[model samples]
Target: MRSIFYIFFFCLGFIGYSQELNCSLVVNAQQTGNENQSIFKTLEKQLTEFINNSKWTSRSVAPQERIDCSMVITITDYSGENFQGTIQVQSSRPVFGSTFNTPVYNFNDRDFSFRYLEFQNLIFNPTQYESNLVSVLAFHVYMVLGLDADTFAKQGGDAYFKQAQTIVNYSQQENYKGWKLEDGLQSRFALIDNLLSPTFSAYREVMYSYHRLGLDVMSENAKRGKEEIASSLKLFEAMNSRRPNSFLLRTFFDAKSDEIEQIFSDGPNVNIASVKETLQSVAPMHSGKWANIKF
Candidate 1:
């Protein structure tokens, strides 16, 4: 009976700690010298286990349901315990009832600075900024969750966004660069803050429609899905008219630019000239890329 009880508890613990991210981590330490560069190889293994094993959400994510994402940290310079580099975070979710996986979030953070000692455990305290590397990873984790959730349901990611906001609040207490509002409009603060604000509802709506209604149904009903996506583009048009060249809006285009062109390659239901007009009006900076809209 005691063995049975122990097994039950073990299963319960596994369920409780089931993480949702299928994350791949690559730690590039080319900038550092060969003397101690082998340490980065160790760091890579540790970071992978830390991110993949740590449960970031309470949702019961099945093994197959784990979100697919990758983190590339290019360590350009390191000194003993100090490390400096950039991290590129990318995540994509499988569309419902389809084989297609759409990119949900992609961000390159350039202002990463952290300290790490070999064999030290990374304690991820969500409510506090314990270390730059963990804090940054935690922030991006929440952002990815929020963005992925928003794609499935209308404003479904509010809880995750609020959680990210809490991290941002915690980060402000520390002396970091990316966590500051004065860091510039492209800072981490701008990204989440804009996402949560009521003013960006149109952008969030685009997220919802572009995925759940648009990409998800493409295989089953191409016309209907294309209509959903094309109609959703008008939201960006409205956003640009209301708040031109917004940070989050630019992020939207940055993520979808290539996919957008591909989607319309089938001669979608959208009017090409009208599409050009909207693209030029809302996200004109990407106008050169949109030149291929030859419909």
Candidate 2:
């Protein structure tokens, strides 16, 4: 009985040792040219507030506890008539790292023409812009977590998947949406649509990675993982089929199931030539058809 008890305690310790969550973010801001101390100070305060208020992670880790993060904002160009700036955010955690860099969100003198010239020249409305910034920052955190889950799963980190799922579950919650620094900003704010617009393809790619990871986990124990993989694959197929001109669906079809299986079986070392061959076979059939379309 004592030996059995010791074994059980050892197993518990192993589980505890395997789970972890930590992250950090840096914000950088700059103006087009030298600006008054007051303007710079205002921008710094707004950026800091957004970071402090936004719940960037689902794991309940505090911002101060984040491992490494940096943000730099540069006012790149400020003509008397127009103000331009740049904001770059860099984040890192034990499992992942990412950077978001963008040109200044611009505002013109004409728009501020009526206000006191000093205040008018400020360009972007900090109050209005705060929500958008928060959205971008928050989503970046989500993406990093999602990708980390995939990477870790491939490398045999089941705990990471649980962490990723926590993030996904949190994002779907009404209360979580209200956690943003700016209460007035609606959930799924325009920033989600804008910052994520060009990366729609990348989203689909991640879905595929997630599906593969799910399948691998499920394969280890069919009864335990099967339902989750099936659900994830169904969602991926539906999304790929619906997207207009989705390169992934086209590529998937062109490659065919056999090729896909081979790629999966071969793991990450699978070559592009084999993938291309599979793509050629599968793409033709599914080019215009939804993956879920019924006969």
Point to the candidate with the largest TM-score: 1
Most accurate candidate by lDDT: 1
- How do the residues 1-295 of candidate 1 rate in per-residue lDDT, one tens digit apiece? 9999999999887765678899999998766655355688888999999989998987876677788999999988888798888999999998778777878888988888888999898988867778877888889998998899899899998988898888888877667788888988888888888998788789899999999888888878888888888888888876677788998877888888888877876644667677677777888878777788775
TM-score of each: 0.91, 0.33
Global lDDT scores for all candidate models: 0.84, 0.37
Give the 10-residue window scoring lowest on summed lDDT in candidate 1.
Answer: 29-38
Q: Where does the lowest 10-residue lDDT sum fall in candidate 2?
A: 106-115
Candidate 2 local Cα displacement, residue 210, angstroms: 5.4
Candidate 2 lDDT by residue in tens digits, 47-128: 4555544444335443334334445545555554343443443433331121311111111111110111233322222123
